[model samples]
Target: MTTVLWFRRDLRLHDHPALTAALETGPVAPLFVIDPPLVHGRWASPNRTAFLLATLHELDAALRERGARLHIRLGNPTREVPQFAREAGAQRVIVTRDYTPYSRRRDAAVARALEALGIAFHTRRGLLVHEPEEIRNATGKPIAVFTPFYRVWQTLPLRPLHPSPAHIPGAPGLDPGEIPTPASLGLPRPVDALPAAGETAARARLQRFLAGPVCTYAETRDRLDLPGTSRISQDLHLGLLSPVEVVTRARTLGCDTAKFVAEVAWRDFYHHILWHHPRVLHEPFQAAFRSLPWRNAPAHFTAWATGQTGYPLVDAAMRELAATGYLHNRARMVVASFLAKDLLLDWRLGETHFMRHLVDGDVANNDGGWQWAASVGTDAQPYFRIFNPVIQSKKFDPEGAYIRRWVPELRRVPESYLHEPWTMPPSAQEAAHCVIGHDYPPPIVDHTLARQQAITTYERARRASASEPPTQADR
Candidate 1:
């Protein structure tokens, strides 16, 4: 019996769980469905769509080298997959499991459709190093706290990375529709300098990173000016690289590398949180936090989105995100904190924006991070732990190099004033060849006032309902 391997986020052929299973079953039909519900869904962006299509093209070429090919279909997977299965004469379909409210529902619907066609549907854990349910606490509940979850995560033995198939058997040929374009979907063409696509590039990056930069990852991952973290976040998100392969290789390097491996667990930790508590997507993870009044001002959001916020670090980070569809990890935290705390905008607004722009954006990680910064998530930064943009800029981008890199108008400003350009005197600003309101936007909100307001807002909510039994919303 032939098996059809359905490819979703796990786009590559190398070290793929479902692909491996399908290969063992004999000739396999590889399928990719451009589900409209997914492409035009919330948090969707042309950058990710572009990467996906380019990656699919690369995947198809790789499959062709093995006498196999990827079949591209545009529509609902539940309706299209079963039809493809019948056409290919497949008796079973194997897929990597996805965890997210929408994905779970989609998979279930597809399974129901496949069942009626007399085809068995099987899914395996491949996206994460550990299934969210497998490495839980003693009470059989997923850990909401990251440190303890990471500690438990460290002890779990990892599965060996599966090798890519040397020769994937051919699929029954059929019409694989035209590859999608951004315009066809009413989206702009991606302009960001995205990472190279496909498994080949992913493996190369893994080898290159493990060889040189990983040793300093602990020290540098937090520095926005340095290439400390593996920029492989996008690759991992697209399944161009396997989490198993990444963890196993890093483990062989000893403690420093092991620390890097734990960061990978952070990805899983968020996924586990979302799987058990899907409501975090729509509501605050912390219940009391739900009561905090948010100023959903379009003008404020516009300034924030367009990088005209007048806050140097915040604007720089936002501009970087807008221009490249990527932001440094430290910048992500700082900017997120600024948005949800300083501006007092809903974390959901910032969360959705990041998801729309980041090529590496995953709903679980993005939502978890927003809630963390907004002080409404698992192991959230205390509400009082507000990040001062100027301080964060000086601390992380000490030389203001990252700021200057993106906000070039502030290039001539001295290091002391670059982080707080509004603090500069007119002469110093002129001497620096920069004007606060002209060359750069003025700070959108007074940091001092906003900080006090945010603190009071959170404090009042926590105290007023101190006796309210906390829900996952209060995470």
Candidate 2:
């Protein structure tokens, strides 16, 4: 009997449950399907596509080293996977499960098709450390809030690490298809800088982070100017490194690993939320805030998108995202807060924009983060408690190092006025060779006024919602 090892988000060979399961059955036909929706849909990103292509090439190379090769196919998985399995004469197909709404639906369709062909379809939990259903509240319902969910998540037992196969035997006379380039998928070749892809690069990064930076991650993670983050988000998103391996290795480092571990748990938390409440993708989690008024100003959004918002930290973060497809955690919060609160724009706009730019943008985490910033999701920041861009800049990028690096117009500006360039006098601005409206745009909206307006908007929405009769339209 032969089996097909279907690769999805879980790309690496190490610690792969589905691959091991397939190997146990018989010689495996390793398969990767390039679904059209992922390449041409709204969430399609050029940078991400480039990274995925490079990662696939690396994965194929690794498979060849083990006397096996990855089979590539293009088109819908619902049709392609079953067809390929029949052609390969495989009796079973083993795959890692994905939790997204689209993924779940597609998997069901593929399963039905495979069953009709007499192929046993098996899915293993590999994307996350724990499945969503495994962790719940005392009432047997999914946990809505993060802290309690995290506390429960810490108590669960992790699955033992699955060893990588030294040799993977393949079925005879099977032709391995070539991995396609980004342009073939109708995506532009990425112009922005991106990290090296594949399992080896991911392991190296994880090892380096655990060796030192993770010890001080809690305190220094908020400092945007420092190289404080693990920078392994892309690896985790691409499945270059498994969450199980990451958590297991970090556990050996002692108490310093707690904060970093919590971050990993946060990834699980968002996925858990998405698994239980897929509606959050299209609407606010908190029903009362569903009809909250948003200005949806296109001009303000343009300013924010192009890094001309005149807020140093916000501009710097936006520019960094455009140039490198990555942003610091603190910077992400600041820019997200600015868009939702200060600009009174719909959080979905910012969410969609981030998805299009960030190489590490996963549906669950990105949507959860945007909703949290907008104060519309479980355990989100209070609507009245908005981030002050200037204050955040002073606290995180105090020396203007991060700001200057990304926003070059502010390079000559004095450190004192860097965060609030508009506060600089005419003579000071002239001396610095940068004028507020000429070289750098002025602040798009006054934070103080925007904060008050946002508070009033939410308060008014709550009162109106309280008086209105319940309607089916409410989420």
Candidate 3:
């Protein structure tokens, strides 16, 4: 009675409920399907794919340490998973559940296919600390707002952590296939600045962060220049580290851990929102705002994407994302705000761009963050609350350390003019040896004017909606 353990996002061997369940039933055959749609999709980023491949290699090594091996197949999961399960002579397939729209459909199709083949299909909750349906309002409906959701989430209990099995009995005589390279997947070679990938690396990073940084995370998490934040997002995104392990470890570190835990809760909140409302992937979470007029300025978007926006902080953040496949959390908000509020562009465009470049880009979190910045989602920022890039720059990167690092043309500028170089007089620009619009391009859009335009646009949309009658096509 062998069971097939299908690995998707949950890449690690530790604290894996699905793997533990499969091992409990009988000897286990581990399988990973390289779904063609995902490997070749528009959301595909070479950095993320490369990191996943590296993590898979590490997973294989860990599996071999036990008495098992990971079998790899290339095709659609609906077809490939059942075929592989039958070939392995497995009676059941166990997998960790996923909440994305595509994943939900794929899993359903696979489950149906497996059923037709007389195989049992089971799923376990390992992606989040609690299942999406587990935490809801008093009425048993999913909570749409984060504050209330987080409040309810705090009251819920996490499942006890499951330790890795001491031995994983391998399904005998099965061929463990080779993990494909980026080139083999028709993707470009990954950028060099990606963090190391693997369960070992993820565990080490967690230990290091807990040893010191977790204590100051409350005060320093927002600082752009400091290495005060944990860079474990990619690991979590790839499931190299389990959320249970992360939360359980953070809780023991004392009061400062509350803020970090709250951040984790926010991740859960977004997943819950995404689980209940799948349309947020393409439209505004607030239905009334769906038809908000977006300027969709092309040249402005291109400047922002290429890191030539002339606003030092925004430019620095964009350049950092391009050079390395990661951006500081605080910088993410600033750039997102600049794109949506300042340039008056569509938030989806910025979201798509981030997914295209970020190594840790998860759909739920990315869409939620963009919508929050754009004031179009559940628990979103007030429509009138626009971020002033200059103010944010001076507050977070006060000494301009982050700005100077990525925007080298500003290296010679005085500290006074570092954040607002466009305001420098001709004489001051020459004295600093970095002339405005020459050494560094002048500000692409005036912050003052852009903010007003954004407010006006939102107001106009609100009025238009108020005057119109409800229609079935609103959603």
Candidate 4:
């Protein structure tokens, strides 16, 4: 009557549905498998890898506190999970479900392998407030858009929280493999320092945000210069903090928690979108724009990626992401809009770049966000409704604090010309001890010209999607 509990994103013990359910059956052998392809394959991420390794250590220590320890395996989960389960004499393998396209495929393979060995494979709902199948359209498919989904999501009752087990009986006589360091994996330690990882740290951060930040989140969330946001996206990504725990706790505080809860609903919405339409992974959800022409200019892309674009806000967000493996949600929208609309690069390129760099990159959320900015997803911005970079900078980062912190070359530039340093006269530039094209690079592309051209190109694609043949990218 033993079970192998495989931890994926839901790394925590408190409020864990799968862990609680598994422990009810019998003693549990907690397991974590590090797949090679995730660490070294096409979509590898150094920042996330470093963070995961650190979190695994914390999870292991937490298990030891409860008379259990984490078991590690380094290989394909399809092979490793079942192998470890059988070796531990477990009759079943249990996990909290993940909904990405790749995760679904991996889970299916693992289940098939486990079934062949007469081991029951069970998936529990703990990561999201509602699974894809739980909220559906009239057609019985997951809701395609968020508004209708949210309308239904709020009315549903939430399952009560599960208390952590006082004692966990670990499977006897199994070798818990050693956790590997970044160097041992042939990857460099991340330059951006990661947060104190694990459930305890996750809960502490949540408490800090709840103390005061959650009350004014609706008012100050958009100001990019201020630290007004919860900054818990990374913890949510790794499942150190359960969505249910975060949402339920915030509501209990008696603040106007609607907006914050709505944001959580948005996260659940994207997961449901990915669950229903896996094709969104390789193509746009709004199929009409899949064939949309992208300039994909190498020079423009290089400038945008390295934070050398003449626009200060765009540059600051990209640079901040490089330095800290994190960015404010407001900043995320600005840079994403700049990339897809202004630069007219392929949105997928930006998505892949972020996944490779961000510590909190989740497939459903990141893809949905990139596609939204690109104007090619459900509830997306209209392609013609472009973000004027200068206007956005002045509105969201009015004081230029964010730009100054990330782009020090503009620190000496006066407040008047900080957002548009190229506009400063040569004499004024000298007074500030900064020179455009000398100290800081000039704007790579003219926004006015780019804006006009982008609108025309998108209009042309809109027509093509209705009548003319699609472009090669669509094929």
Candidate 5:
């Protein structure tokens, strides 16, 4: 009997555990389900959808080159996988496990469905270095803070990386439909250049980053003007590149490259947190933060969404996201912090917006970043630590080259006034060829007032928490 390989976010053929498992079986049927939840979710964006479709097309092509093809299915995995297995006469299903609550539940339902049909189910663990329950504190509970969680994560042993299988045991009888496009999914067309997909492109990207930028990554990653960071986040999120391969490669480079390796660890760190504390998805990770009075303003959210925030740096980041389906990490932080702290909006709003735009967006990273900015998640930055958009622009993008690249109106402004066009003299503003209120919106909210309000609001929430102590303190 053939084994079924169920592909989700792990799209690539190389360094894939489930794919390896399927090959080890007699014959394999590779499958991907385009579920309604994924299609209609808030995180779904035309840009992301287009990139995903393109990637599937690439993966399908790669499989064809190897005398196999990805079997694309459209329906709930629980309903689809079992049906596909029964139709194809498969005895077992193989898949890379996902830590997100939605994925976990979906997989469980599929597993149960398969078991009832007398089909075996197997899941692989290496999507993350440390599986959620694998790393625990001395007390056997998941760590709630990142620093301690990271420290604990460092000590956990990881599996060795696997090479891509040369031959995928083909389930020759099964045929699949055409891979869906953004239009087929009823999504708008994306207007950005997505990186080429498949194991080949992923490996080449890793090799190129190692040859040059890996050394300076620690220093230049924060500089928005430089192409310092490895632009592999989308690849990793899509599973075109495995975390183990990335970590192993970074270690092979040594010295400063270790920092790049640590960033991979950071990705795992967030995934483990989400797996252990799934509540972080719907509520604050830190209990005291549950009471935050987040402003629920849809119009303000629309402005932030369309990049018309009246703050150049924030607006520029938002515009970049709208145009490119990507934003620099520093820009992500600035825009996220501006939305949550300065704009006093809910972190979920920002999280959804990011998911909609970022080609690199992952459930763990997007949620972790938003919660950190909002000071509501494990190891989150304090809420009082608000970022002033103007100062942040000057500090990170000093030449305003980054701003000028995305925001053409600010191109003629002197570097000194690029971050603060409103500060320019009336004549200087005219000479720069733009009007603050006419060409661009004014600052939506005064930074100073917002900062103080955010601080006070957080402080009050923390202070107002229930003081009742647990009756059974320590077992």
Candidate 6:
């Protein structure tokens, strides 16, 4: 009997444990089900959806080279997977394990459906270098803080890299269904063109980063004006590049790979958090900040989202996200902090907005990042530790090159006034062919005032939680 390998985020043909395991069983049939709810639902992104389609096409091409083609179907995986297996005469179904709340629920349903069909349902550790529950503390519980978790992650050894299967043994009599286009699926064309798709593009990016930029990654990663990042985050998100493969290759460079490798480890850490505390996706992980009095200033949020925040760095980052479906890591922190702290808006506001745009958006990483920015998660920054947008802009984007690139109106503004353009005197503003209120939106809220307000609000919530009795779970 054949084995059906159902692919989700693991879209690549290379370094796939589930695909390899499926082959070990007998002939293998690779399948991808385009779930409508996930593809066009509230959390759906045109950018990511388009990238996924292209990646899937590339995957089908790769499979054809291996004497097979990716089997595509449209519907719920729970119903479609079982039916597909029956058609292929597959006795077992295998997939890469996913840890998000929704993924868990979906997988549970899929497993039960397959069981009823008498097909073995199995998951392999393919997404992360280490499974969420694998790394443990002194007492064997999963570590909550990233530092300790990363330290433990380092000691855990990794297996050597293996090449893609020489050829995928095809299961005959399976139809390779229609590969849907974005228009057919009702996904809009993205404002920005997506990165090159597939395992080839992913590997090329990883190879280039490991070759050069990685040497200065530690020092230049935070720089806004340079291509300091590896830019393979989307690849990791779609499993075009495997986490272990990236890490193992980075270690071989013999440079200070600790920083670069830690970024990958951070992805693992966030996944672990999701696995242990699935509730964090919808609520504050720290619990006390669950009562944070977030504002309902839709206008402020609109301004921030459209890149008219009047803060150059924040504006640049937001516009970049809108245009490219990506953002610099430092800019992400700054913008997220501005939304939650400066604007006193809910972190979920920014979090959901990001999900709507980011190509690299992963549930675990995006949630972990938002919670960290809002100071409402495990090992989050303190409420008082708010970012001063002007300081961050000047320090990271000293020359305003990034701001100029994203916000063209600020192009003529002198570098001295670029970081805080509203501060420019009328004469200087006129001289630069820009006026603060007319040419650009003024700062919606004074950072100093907003910072104080955020601190007081967080302190109030902290006090309120302290006064309340602990839950039975806490006890």
Better of 2 and 5 by lDDT: 2
Q: 3 or 4: which has the higher TM-score?
A: 3
How well is each residue in 1-475 modelled by candidate 1, as lDDT tens digits?
A: 7888999889887778788888887889889999897688887888888888888999999998998889989998989999999999999999999999999999999999999989999998789999987878889888999999998988888876788888999776677667777888888878659888777887888899999899988888888888887888989888888898898888788557866887899999999999999999998877777778898789989998888899888888999999989998788898888888899999888999988888889999999988998999989999999999988888898998898998889999998888899899999999998988898889889999999999999999888778677656345
lDDT of each: 0.88, 0.92, 0.90, 0.88, 0.83, 0.91
- Which candidate achieves the best lDDT against the true structure? 2
* Candidate 6: C-alpha lDDT: 0.91
Worst 10 residues of 2 by lDDT: 183-192
lDDT (10s digit) by residue, model 4, range 1-475? 9989999999998989999988887889999999998898766788988989999999999999998999999999999998998898889998999998788899999999999999999999998988788897778766777899999898888889998888898887899999998889998668656777778888899899999999999998999988788888989988989898888888898779889989999999999888878888889987688778888499988889889998999999999888888878888888888888888999999999898888898888999999898889988988888888888899998989988989999998889999899999999989888889988899888889988888898888888788956567457
- Candidate 4 residue spans exceeding 4 A from truth: 468-475
What is the lDDT, from 0 to 100, of the residue 157 in candidate 2? 94
The Cα error of candidate 5 at residue 407, in Å, is 1.3
Candidate 3: residue pairs that collide: none
Scored against the true structure, residue 347 in model 6 reaches a CA lDDT of 96
Give the clashing pairs for model 1.
285-473, 285-474, 285-475, 286-473, 286-474, 286-475, 287-473, 287-474
TM-score, one value per model: 0.97, 0.98, 0.98, 0.97, 0.95, 0.98
- Ranking of predictions according to lDDT: 2, 6, 3, 4, 1, 5
Candidate 4 Cα RMSD (Å): 2.0
Candidate 2: segments with Cα more than 4 A from true spot? 472-475
Q: Tell me, what's the RMSD of every candidate? A: 1.8, 1.1, 1.2, 2.0, 2.2, 1.0
lDDT of 1: 0.88
Better of 2 and 5 by TM-score: 2
Model 4 Cα shift for residue 360 (angstroms) = 0.3
Query: With candidate 6 superimposed using the best TM-score fit, by how many Å does residue 424's alpha carbon deviate from the native?
Result: 1.2
Model 2 C-alpha lDDT per residue in residues 87-152, reported as the tens digit of each score: 899999999999999999999999999999888899998999999999988999999888999989
